[model samples]
Target: MMKGLVSFFFLLAGCHQAAGAVNTKTILLFPEATSTNYVSLKPTEKVLHQITVCLRSYTDLTREHSLFSLATPNKDNAFLIYFSPPNNISISINNEDIFIKVDPDVYYWKKTCVTWDSTNGLLQLWINNKRYPRRVTKTRSPIGPQMSVVLGQEQDSYGGGFDINQSFLGEMCDVNMWDSVLPETSVRVILTDQFSLTGNIYNWNDENFQVHGPILVLKDQYI
Candidate 1:
C-alpha cells in the first residue's frame, strides 16, 4: 500500500512537469508559396488589440506582405500589420492606417510590438526594444469584441478574402496578445527571447490554433 501511494504521487509530479514544458514550447510557421498559410485563433470573449509578433522574413522588401491581423466580420473593426512594397511597415487600426520606413538590415528575425487603447486613442509601436513616436486614433470608440485573429495573412473581409500579393512568405514565432497594454519592460523581455511571462488573451504556447493551407511547423531556430 505504501509503495503504491508513493508511485502515484510521483506520477502526478511527472505529469505536472510535462504540462509545464509544453506550455513554454514555441512553434515556427513556414508559409506557402502561392496560397495563404495561416493560424486561426479561437475567438475570445473580448478583443485584445495589443499584440506582439516575433518573426523573420526572407522575402525581399520590394514585395508587399501581411504579418498578422485581427479581423472582424465588419471591415471597420479590423487591425492589421503588414509590409508595404519597397520598404515600409504599416499598421491599420479600425480604418485608419499608419506606416513608417524600415531599414533594410533590421528585417531579419525582429520583434515588433503594437499597442492601442481605444479610450485614449493612443497607439504605439516598438521594434526590437526601440520605441516609435506615439500616435492617437479612433478616440470615439473601442475595438469591437468579436475578432478573428489570423497569422501570415491579412483578412480583407471577415475570415476569408486573402490576397496573394499580401501573403507572408517567411517564418513566425512567439506571438502574443493582451487585453491591456503591457509595460515597456515586459515588451523588452520578449524581444530578448525570454518569454517568462506573456499576454492573457492569446499566448502562442498555451493556446491552440488551426493551421490553414500548406503551412509547415518547424522547430523555432531563432529562439
Candidate 2:
C-alpha cells in the first residue's frame, strides 16, 4: 500500500510537469475560430492589429502558403498563408517577411516575432522576444475580414504548396492579438515574463487550461 501511494504521487508529479503553467493573462481567446466573433481593421487602422495562433508542422502538403489564415485584428479584412518550413521560417504579409527564429538563450524555444511601428507603420524582426534595433519597413496596407481565424490549415487551400517536407511542428501558447502597437516595456513585460496590462489587451486566457472564454473586449482605441 505504501509503495502504491508513492507511485501515485510520482504519477501526479509527472502529470503536472507535462501540463505546464500557461500564462493565461497573455493568452488570447477567440470563439474557436469558427464563429463570427472577430473584428476587422483596414486602411483606417492600417497595419495595426492583434493576433494569437498556435502552429504545428505535421502535414504532407509541402508548401508555406496554406497553413494559417488571419483576421485583420478587426472584422474588415483577412489574409491567409500556406507556409512550409526548413528554407525560410517566415510569413509574408503585404510583401514583408515576418519571420521566426529560435534563440538559444530566450524563454520560448522558438519565437515568431515581428515588430510593428505605430508611428509610421513599419516592422522589425526579433527572435525570442529580443528586439532588433532596426525597423524593416514603413508601408501601411489594409488587412482583412475579421471572422474565423484558422490554424494548422489554410481556409481556402487544402494543402500548402511547397516542398511537402516542411511544416510548422509545435504547439503555440499564450497566443495574443493586439490592435495597436504595444510599447517596448509592455511587450517585454508580457513576452519576457507574465503580467497583466490595464486596457489594451484584446484576448486573454481566463484560466491556464483555456477552458474559459475571452472576457475582455474594447473598441479600437488602443492605438
Candidate 3:
C-alpha cells in the first residue's frame, strides 16, 4: 500500500509539473511538432466588440503553423493567427480567413500583433511594430462568449481535433490579449518593451493559463 501511494503521488507531480500559470518574462518551449502540447488561456466570460492579441516567438519552421487559436462552439477558427512561411500570415475571424502579405523574414524572435473592432470592422496586423494595410470583416458581429483559446495548436473543434502539421514548434513569450483595440502609441510602447502593459482580457502571468503535455516554461533570458 505504501509503495502504491508513493508511485501515485509521483505520477501526479510529473503530470502537473508546469500545469499552472506562467509569468511575463517566461517563455513556453514546445520542443516538438506534436499536437498534444499546448497552453490553454482562461479569461473571464464576456462578449467582445474588439480584441487585440500580441506575442513573440522564435522558430525556424518553414511550413504553415498556428501561433494563436481561439475558438467558439460553432467556429473553430473564430480568432486564429496562422502563418505560412516566407510572407503569408492569416487572421481568421468568425470562420473567415484573411491574409496579409508581409516581408519574408518572419521567423526568429518575431513580434506580432493583431487588432479588430466590430464597430468599424477594421482589422490590422503588425509585425515588429510595422503595421500593414487595414482590412475589414464581420462588420457588425461582436464575438460571443464561451471561448476556448489555445496556443501551439489550431483547433478543428471547440477544444479538440488538433493537427500536428499545424502545431507551433518553438519558444513563445509575451502572449497577451485585450478586450479593446489598442492605440498605435500603446502598441509602439509594447514593441519597444518600454512598459509591461498587460492585457485586461488575457496576459502571460502565473495565474491565467494551464499547460498540457511535455511543455517547458523557462525564463526568457536563458534562451
> What TM-score fits each model?
0.78, 0.46, 0.86
Best by TM-score: 3
lDDT of 2 by residue, 9-30 (tens): 9988865653344322232223
Candidate 1: where are CA atoms >4 Å away?
Answer: 1-25, 47-61, 105-107, 220-222
Best model number under lDDT: 3
What local distance difference test score does each model get? 0.67, 0.38, 0.86
Task: Predict model 1's lDDT versus the native.
Answer: 0.67
Tell me the lDDT of model 1 at 37. Answer: 67
lDDT of 1 by residue, 5-77 (tens): 9999998887676445434345555545454567788747575445444433444435777777877767622
> Between which residue pairs do clashes occur in model 1?
none
What TM-score would candidate 1 get against the native? 0.78
Error of 1 at 212 (Å): 0.8
lDDT of 1 at 116: 78
